[model samples]
Target: MALTGKLEIDVEIKAPPDKFHDMFCNRPHHSQHACNDKIKGCDLHDGDWGTVGSVIFWSYVRDGKAKTLKEVVEAIDSEKNSITFRVLEGDVMKDFKSYVITIQASPKSGGEGSIVHWTMEYEKQHEGIAHPEDALQFAVEISKDIDSHLTQGN
Candidate 1:
């Protein structure tokens, strides 16, 4: 019954690593266009997309229930193809005191596709709250949708 925990998973994609990085760092607001069902909307609240300190709001469906959350772009490194998001409000905030998600896409050695790594670190509001496994799965699906959309013609 630890108050803090970390969950990590990796998803393989046919698209290149740069493709994944470009989407999250460049046109994240258009993610809904990639997956209409999972992601309902992505709006910019402050600063601009692809830059650090930007605030973004997301509306989506997770586990058959509608959910919403806001996050600030904590960091983005093009060289490593990594981006970090610090959760600020909405559904996730209700159960956790702090939530941070970091995604990194890297080329698989001697392979055409990329390996996308997901890391979620959070502190529960109380010991009763379960770890956010569903949320991480939801993120995986979202990344897959974006990968499909971006690599459509390539």
Candidate 2:
């Protein structure tokens, strides 16, 4: 079965997309203990940081155990300030099989405001492995944290 969700948040970034994207995609910059010690590492294997098709590996704690997630860039539109990535291997790989996550930002009408959108699409291996809404809520929380960090002048 297929599952999907969308999350939206308002943010004010001290830096532009290029800067914001680079910092967030890098993972380490925002994965500190205070933010989330669960992450042990995130590496971009191909192309430069924030470029389409770059692979990233994330190590984290899940279910009281350590797990790693591997993902690849599926799409990117700098002009629209969007990037999409698909999970390839790792803990959730067995159950979800595949997942696509996208992040995008649009300039608010006033030019001082901005809206960030986070979307996820996934295919489940079994009939009842994970609830789509649960994943969506987690994604929303992560997005909110990221937005808050940048807007807080971090």
Candidate 3:
């Protein structure tokens, strides 16, 4: 069986695309306030926000377990409104040799809201390990939380 795989998920949000993209690029730490239940907090370990090669540490609860992750900002494309992160260490590294996630927020074709797209790519340590579907679900939920947080005042 193949050991490398990818998963893509998209969620619709009432928040504007620019604001949604800004959260990922320059204000990821705000996630703690937006969704403390899942995202405990995030801190900058090196460099600055919205810059390539920045290192960030994340704390969160998943599957009723607390987990930590260290990731580097791999790429950023403002025109595309996307950011890519490469996981250096974390709960997921226990099962995957390498993991990368890319997220993009774009304007919906019809009008007012945005569409957030999450893509995860991984190489499993063993064929027995399952895919990261739960992570995708978490992303979806977090997108909603962020949407609500951003749209609450409007």
TM-score attained by model 1: 0.97
State each model's CA lDDT, in order.
0.92, 0.63, 0.95
lDDT of 3 at 151: 96
**Model 1 weakest lDDT span, ten residues long:** 134-143
What TM-score does each of the candidates earn?
0.97, 0.73, 0.98
Residue-level lDDT for 33 in candidate 2: 37
Q: Please list all clashing residue pairs in model 1, or write none if there are none.
A: none
Best by TM-score: 3
Instruction: TM-score for candidate 2, please give it.
Output: 0.73
For candidate 2, the clash count comes to 0
| Worst 10-residue lDDT window, candidate 2 | 2-11
lDDT of each residue in 1-154, candidate 1, tens digit only: 8999999999888889998889888888788999899889999999988999999999988778999999999999999999999999999999999999999999988979899999999999999999999877887898899889988988
lDDT of 2 by residue, 29-131 (tens): 3554324744556766666666677878878764467888888877878777778889999987877767777777666566654556667677777777755
Model 3 clashing residue pairs (backbone): none
Which regions of candidate 2 deviate over 4 angstroms? 1-19, 25-34, 62-65, 109-111
Best by lDDT: 3
